[model samples]
Target: MLKDKVVVITGASSGIGLLTARLLSEEGAVPILAARSRQKLAEASSGIAGKHEIKVLDVTREDQVKQMINEIIADHGQIDILLNNAGYGQFESIVDMPSEEFGRMMDVNYMGIVRCTKAVLPHMLGRGSGRIVNVASMAGKIGTAKSTAYTATKHAVLGFSNALRQELRGTGVTVSTVNPGPIDTPFFELADPAGGYTSNVKWLMMKPEYVARKIVRFMDSGKEELNLPLKAAAAMRFYQLCPRLADRLTYRMMNKK
Candidate 1:
């Protein structure tokens, strides 16, 4: 089903986004790599074998998001998929986190998704067939210490996806969310500069390729949500069912950073 499809993937410069672009290319899909770095996007596309395009986009900017979407539609005639994968996090307690940093995180993580989705929705709705996949995190499902800002952004993403999915029902456009646990990627360099959280959970870290494959599957699965690392998904469900007990246990486990 993905063959010959035009996929627009934000954050396509690296990590799961880049990997998924490669996989989609392998499946004969035309992946449009979108990111803020033109150099990085070029480098990422150079490695893929099949047809692809790269767009310089800063999702935080409404103008850029709108322009990118417009250009994609103009060039491709239609966009079959939109993968909102551009986001970052900084792990810090609320007291220590700078207000500016929190706002920036919100802008890039949550509002970025909003901007991109709003820009692309009109095109998708007109065509009456498109898939919108959002890359949230396990943090969104279960809050932990030192992740107030990051978790809040992801929680907002989940809420947005859920509501948007409902709104898009019967419109032939679907909204899907990918909630993955810690993956081995450069993201932690910024999110955990101290390297404490990475070290503490190194054993549980998943490879970017693993998560990327799951994301590719989700693009056409018609599923609403994809939570990774069976164990983490189970834990999220447990937390929802037993907030008090899970809070004590999860806090002890996640507070090691």
Candidate 2:
């Protein structure tokens, strides 16, 4: 049952992770909020009316990830679910973005998820039960302009989720990926200081609450993957199936904008 389940959520300070934490807490799950900012975590914990824990964790750090998992197991006995939702975007063109910044984007969005997953697996395997819900983006399936680094990182996330799901299949563990479109959250505002926000996302933005509802249901149902905003998912699938046409059409639409 979701009630009392020990769910650890990364990126819980804001956006989708924060929303999910609050929603799950309302549903009776003991949501543990994890992020790099302690103050924000504290504020979020206090604002929420349910029982939850907050931890200052930089997902890109190996030692911190390991320590957090060990600590959670010690306190909670077992981790019922792990939400690898902490991520940032660098919406810079390849020419403008330096190698160091590009690498950091990979470190946070891609390696962050990898490190968090590694830390939780040993504990879950020992108990032979757990769930992992990864927040990927529709960018993973279809590339977007001026977001090469972010897109690549999300694609890596999707690849990792796919492989991990197969490896853990039938082992009393399940992995699911949430591929969401543009969400009307401060995620873009916080991540991109240059206001490099692409024009492509203006019409397609969604609410974090919408995605939170999906996350809760996806966890309960043990869904293999979810491509949210049904129409967007459909279009992306078609793009994957017909890259040439998708490219031409997307380029034309983008040019018109």
Candidate maximizing lDDT: 1
Residue 203's lDDT within candidate 1 is 84
* Per-residue lDDT over 126-201 for candidate 2, one digit per residue giving the tens place of the 0 to 100 score: 8899999999998899886777888899999999999998999878888999999778777777555544353455
Enumerate residue pairs that collide in model 1.
none
Cα lDDT, all candidates: 0.92, 0.87
Question: For candidate 1, which ten residues in a row score worst on lDDT?
Answer: 248-257
TM-score of 2: 0.95
* lDDT per residue as tens, model 1, 1-257: 79999999999999999999999999999999999999998899889999999999999999999998999899889999999999999988889999999899999999999999999999999988899999999989888888999999999999999999999999999999999999999899899998999999988899999988888888868888999987788889998899899998767777866
In TM-score terms, which candidate is top? 1
Per-residue lDDT value at 53 in model 2: 94
- Which residue segments of model 2 deviate by more than 4 Å? 191-200, 254-257
